[model samples]
Target: MTSKRVLVAYGTEHAATAGIAEQIGVTLHEDGLDAVVLPAVVLPADDVDDVRSYDGVVLGGALYAGHWRRKAKRCAERNADHLKHRPVWLFSSGPVDSSAEQHDIPPVRAVAQQMESLAAREHVTFGGSITSHTPGLIAKALVRHGKGGDFRNPERIQTWAHHISAELAALN
Candidate 1:
């Protein structure tokens, strides 16, 4: 089988989002796709970069308050032209509690809306993992307000990755 390269770009806080991105990348690879995980902050500043080389792109961000992190939004905005022409998937990871339901899905944020205009397939909201070990005083405070614990589910992440792989394969 020919290798299909996928870019897993992320905007993260407290490293939780990064871990999720990495797991997605690994899952993609397991499903026979080549995936690279890059932080949104570390991506090249130029809007017109070489991201077109990838067959697909997955952009994930840590949601704070209601919107994605600023860096994540900037990444999408900067690369809007390229992303608009490609298969893109978006995810927002947050919500500290296990009881969260449909309300956990972020309201249509601007960045997500922009991608959606380009035919992005999905915008998933994954439960976040927060603990006392989360860094920074603000993180701690948020954890208290969020009643944080490990709410992330590995199976859900794996299923999402598999679905993405299946969709891409059908396109191919």
Candidate 2:
């Protein structure tokens, strides 16, 4: 049988969310699925049409001030119709701490709305990263204040990717 094709798309400010998306893609591929990771900003203009080519999609964004990045939001909105017809999962990467690992962080208001509109199967929040290397004065200030670090949990991310793979396998 042909392996399922999964699109792992992410919107990131400093490549943190992209790292998460890449991990997910790698895990999915290891599980024998065909996974492609891409930045949301580079998604085709005819997203609805392009989205149809994938068996499933995992959409993620970097959160800033409790809002999803614009590219992620726009990608979800543009492909809403096709996404609703397929298995969809959404994620957000933010919180430069262990909060996400300690407990579930519900989707932000805008993301919640997108979840409903897209009928996404699930939503997950992963810890983000902020470091001195990250651009922006605010990021540097946060790092200087000892509030910045890479909090993404590889084990948790791999577990979730395996779960997604299991679910997709069941569909076939």
Candidate 3:
């Protein structure tokens, strides 16, 4: 099988999002695609192929204080000219506690909407949250607000990755 290039880029404050992005890259590779993971912050300077050059691109960002890190959204938005012409997917590793957070999906809708307007092939939520051990400036503050739980589910992640792989295959 010939490999189709896929870029899985992400931004994270507590590293959770990066882990998920890496998992997706691995999943893609196992499915016979050439996948790479990169930090969204490093994109503007990296020699990596531009968004338009990939067979598919998946962008993920962690949600903090009701927002996906602005840098991730901006990275995707700034590449709209290229992204709009290629298969793209957007994910927000969001939801501290679906039962608690006022907004279930977080504010990634704005970024998702932009992708939709650009005709992204698909969009999904790989739901994530602050675990008890997650510690940092922002994560610490999140805990202060009563956010603590392992909301991540491996099954869900795998299913999403499978769907993305299928979508890209159909595109080709």
Candidate with top lDDT is: 2
- Note the Cα lDDT for every prediction shown: 0.75, 0.87, 0.69
lDDT of 3: 0.69
* TM-score against native, each model: 0.85, 0.93, 0.79
- Cα lDDT tens digits, model 3, 1-172, are 5668888888777777877777888787777777853323223212234576577788777777567776677777677788887887777776766542233442355766766766866666666768657877676777777766666667667777888898888875
How accurate locally is residue 171 in candidate 3, as Cα lDDT from 0 to 100? Answer: 72
What would the TM-score be for candidate 2 when compared with the true structure? 0.93
Candidate 1 lDDT by residue in tens digits, 58-95:
88878777778766677777777888888989887877
Off by over 4 Å in 1: 37-49, 99-107, 142-146
Tell how far residue 153 is off in model 2, in angstroms: 0.5
Ranking by TM-score: 2, 1, 3
Ranking of predictions according to lDDT: 2, 1, 3
Instruction: Tell me which of candidates 1 and 2 scores higher on TM-score.
Output: 2
| Shift of residue 36 alpha carbon in model 1, Å | 3.3
User: How large an RMSD does model 2 have?
Assistant: 2.8
Question: How far off is residue 9 in model 3, in Å?
Answer: 0.4
Worst 10 residues of 3 by lDDT: 38-47
Q: Candidate 2's residue-wise lDDT over 84-164, tens digit each?
A: 999999999999999999999999999999999999999999999998899999999999999999999999999999999
